[model samples]
Target: MKRLAGVGVGWRRQLAHTLDTMEGLGFVEVLAEHLDARGPLPEPLVRLRERGVPVVLHAVSLGLGSAEPPSPERLTWLARLAERLDAVCVSEHLAFVRAGGVESGHLLPLQRGEDALEVLAENVRAAEAALPVPLALENVASLFEWPQPSFSEARLLSGVLERTGAWVLLDVANLYANGLNLGTDTRAVLEAVPRERLAYVHVAGGVKHGGLYHDTHAHPVSTGALMLLEELVARLGPVPALLERDDAFPPPDVLVAELDAMRVALARGVARREAA
Candidate 1:
């Protein structure tokens, strides 16, 4: 698979015009659920595909970490969407949102253990088998973790990657939240991820609410997250870095400024690596 490179943005209808006019964008991700498997893709998305921009299919409801396997229909739709858009890859989170026929309405942390790992590994394998392109699993920001898991966060992810041969969508903001909430070193988490298995990286914004950091994605990227990203770049050189903003859309200039900031941070890290 070709390595995802440079900086990117999540393609949203709110920012479609902004992204459409922007120059030098690396790629853009669209929600798989929002797209139809049939033809007649979204106009802006079609324009982006026409411009030779790589589009990644990101799924929220796959719930790969759940006990149940992802819906066959959903997987088939994702596969069709990837083929329809010529997507570079399809990605989902490591957390589960549903169980026992009930939806959590949010991505919940997985109970780390043999059973959970096996279930997740099975789901990932299923998705990988269905996707025409590669499948990438992302680490979510956890509000709480299960006690004394069989594997560390990195170990669990690495094991899944080893078992399924899937790549990682390492989210720096999520790592920062997890580190802050769990009191673990974020850099250690970064180090544990296999650099070669990284499909891309995610940087987003969040806020501290009720004494806990939330990966809300509605705010600007935090300093701590950007620092972690810089450290990651120092270790892995420059990989594809995608900025995600889910809601509370900002002005086009502010969004562009954030991308510019990431570009500057990545450039500095690349320069430092070359100097070393």
Candidate 2:
């Protein structure tokens, strides 16, 4: 198997310094905004591919698990875009961003209970049917709680993936951030989801404000987040691990150094797991 390491960043648009640095770092996936079925990729995305990096479509507006069906127009857009890139896969969150026919411009949480399964299943099927590669779903960062916490995040994710036979993109920092904010046990969160569905892992840094831990995707990989990732690696074993630094991108070389550190940590984890 390949080493399965990547320096991943969100968005294809660029600033002179940002694009130069990203190109230098040799990121594997440029999480593109427009994987719609019919439009041409922005010039920068074409450039990223020219450098031999693969692009994956991570849509902000694709809200598959929403109350209503995801827009056919958007799905068509994604299908066209996927064809354009020969992408590995397309990813969206386990989120309901639109409700009652209104776009919230954010990934809003559903009250994670029994009522959500049918809706999620329907959306997953729709999303999978339209894409060539398996549709991977990500766990979202939540700052609020429901009056009734129906199922753990893992169970919900596991259920949907199992039903749709889709892939999962596990975000460790999202789990850590939710754990800190909601006082949820991280191990229990880990235990509830199906480890087998984990196709890749994401690690990012966040902000601590007003006694709240927010998944802001700023800063460097924190000690606690890195520790949690180490734990995840031990349990789940090797997966395509990547860092998501959407904002305040350090110079390209600096981010690559951080990616190198992450690899060292992952190697240590794999060794410990194998030894035990």
Candidate 3:
């Protein structure tokens, strides 16, 4: 894949029009929950292929960061999508969303420890084996952090990556949201993530309730998230960066403009780096 510029719209409803706008605006379009194997990708994805737009797969329920192994059913679906789309990368949350001996509805937070590491490793390994593209693990904007005997967040995450040999889809906005909500120092969290290991950035907006933040990804990037994103792009260099807006969706013009702003900011940064 060629170098991806600043922003991408999270593929949501009205996808045809969204792709049309994104194409006109030079924005990459990230594929949505089409990770399911029911049949082929959602019809909107075909429009992207016709337009020759760059596409990446961002999964919501891989449950990689959970305590369960990647289920055979999920693996079958992912393999189908991966082979069909020729995706740049496939990604899921670092937190487990499914629990139960069957199907858990909640996106569960894992206790940061050795046992958790084994769970993450096995899941990632199974996913990597099936999908030809790079397998990516995303940082969850967790509402709670479990008390662990030892292994800090960085240590646990780094250990999983080291053993599994996969990449990280760093969600900078989630990092900030966690800090804003849970009082977890976002910078310390970012440092724990190996700078060189990041494959892309998911930039999005969120809301605050009392002391907690929800990863709504349904608005323009927050002022604080924007600042942190700038630092990330500058330090990490030009990687595929995507904007996720999943609710209270806006008209295409407004969404495209917001993404364009992010694109310009990132381009200026890349230009400045070259001059320096």
Best by TM-score: 1
lDDT at position 216, candidate 3:
82
Question: Model 2: how far is 106 from its true place, Å?
Answer: 1.8
Best-to-worst lDDT order: 1, 2, 3
| Model 1 regions lying over 4 Å from their true place | none
Candidate 3: count the clashes: 2
RMSD of each: 1.2, 2.9, 2.7
Candidates' lDDT values, in order?
Answer: 0.89, 0.71, 0.70
| Candidate 3 weakest ten by summed lDDT | 25-34
Give me candidate 2's TM-score against the actual structure.
Answer: 0.87
lDDT, candidate 3, 140-214, per-residue tens: 777777874365656666788788868887787887887776676666656666656676778888887776777
Report the number of the highest-lDDT candidate.
Answer: 1
Model 1 whole-model lDDT (C-alpha atoms) = 0.89
lDDT of 2 by residue, 1-276 (tens): 012244455543433345544533434454545343455666666776777766566776788777777788788877777778867777788888877877788777766777677788888898788877667788878888778777777677767866787777777888898888877678866665556666567788888989998887668876677777777767767656667777776776676677777777777778878988
lDDT of 3: 0.70
**Span of ten consecutive residues with least summed lDDT in model 1:** 183-192
Clashing pairs in 3: 65-94, 97-107
Stretches of candidate 3 off by over 4 Å are: 1-6, 24-32, 35-40, 193-196, 267-276
